[model samples]
Target: MQPTELMVCTQHAPPIGGAFVVPAPPLPLVPHALKPEILMEAIALLATAVPLALVVALLCATVVCLAAICRAHRTDVVAVVQALPDLALALLRRRRP
Candidate 1:
């Protein structure tokens, strides 16, 4: 039941090679350490994404410019200004029995 008796029964002896093999402590991993394959994968992803991002940006800008042009040149501005009497006549005709 005592610690001494247990140690004696086990008969602890030196390792086979006369030295205990202990694994060296792993080197601490610094942040953002990129392995070759991981770096390559990131590069590939960026290569694919950059052009797509640029295309989307250009499309958005084109759409915005078109919308601005359409808003600035509404249908009301395209036609000649009608006379007041002609406008009243058109309204009268629209409501007559």
Candidate 2:
């Protein structure tokens, strides 16, 4: 084919990069049911309630953790004290070597 025909064919072909563009849809004009004042009040109540709830949860968790730690420490102390005789004998044997 002639160069002019090729040029004409290329010009008539679908434009490049056209697929990348998209037209935005029209927005609906409906008014919101929750107004700014109601939103702010709800947010304020949530802010207060969330921190209070968190503090209560933290206190409960801390109490549980402390109780667990105390129980574990007591058990460990008892075990270690019971083993004192064996530990002393081992120490004496090691010193002679």
Candidate 3:
């Protein structure tokens, strides 16, 4: 083997010194595979969340309306008081020592 044949001169040459450093190219802010999927998943979840929130709001509104309709007329306070449990009445009556 000859020493002249061992020499390689191309753009891909290995650097000679320990102090020599090649500056790295800038990294992308978002990863390649994850970029599109993350945005799509977030939008899908947001779409689902909006409908779920609306259903919950409608259920709360229905309950409030029903309660108002049921309480349109007042009955005797004593009759209402007697219908409650004894423990609840005791708790409401006063603070016990």
Candidate 4:
């Protein structure tokens, strides 16, 4: 084929390896019966509800972690609390060497 003929053939061919592609149909439009105010209210509710739910979940997680830590160190905490009075008395009774 002449170069001019080859160029004319390719000019009408698909860009990708000559594969034919069908154009996608456009999306359907929303019905006129759907109110914009209802959509906006739903969006607003989601905006506030999502963050509020996240904060509550975070707070619940924090409380669970703290409870676990305290449970794990319960004996150590009790021992320190019980020793406070003796430690104070010992400090008061210490004399210069």
lDDT of 4 by residue, 1-97 (tens): 2234334332344545654334555565975436798788889999999999999999999999778768877787778779999999888889534
Q: Which stretches of model 1 miss by more than 4 angstroms?
A: 1-32, 74-97
Which 10-residue span in candidate 3 carries the lowest summed lDDT?
1-10
In candidate 3, the residue pairs with backbone N, CA or C atoms under 3 Å apart (3 or more residues apart, or in different chains) clash, namely: none
Q: Which lDDT values do the candidates have, in the order given?
A: 0.67, 0.71, 0.69, 0.72
What ordering of candidates by lDDT runs from best to worst? 4, 2, 3, 1
Local distance difference test, candidate 1: 0.67
Which residue segments of model 4 deviate by more than 4 Å? 1-33, 73-97
Top candidate by TM-score: 1
Model 1, residue pairs in steric clash:
none
The per-residue C-alpha lDDT of model 4 at residue 18 equals: 50
Residue-level error in angstroms, candidate 1, position 73: 3.3
**lDDT against true structure, model 3:** 0.69
Backbone clashes under 3 angstroms, per model: 0, 0, 0, 0
CA lDDT of 51 in candidate 4?
100
Cα shift from native, residue 55, model 2 (Å)? 0.6
TM-score of each model, paired residue for residue: 0.44, 0.41, 0.41, 0.41
**Candidate 1 residue-pair clash tally:** 0
The sequence of per-residue lDDT tens digits that candidate 1 reaches over residues 1-97 is 2244223323445444554334455576853447777788999999999999999999999999778667765654444244556888999999998
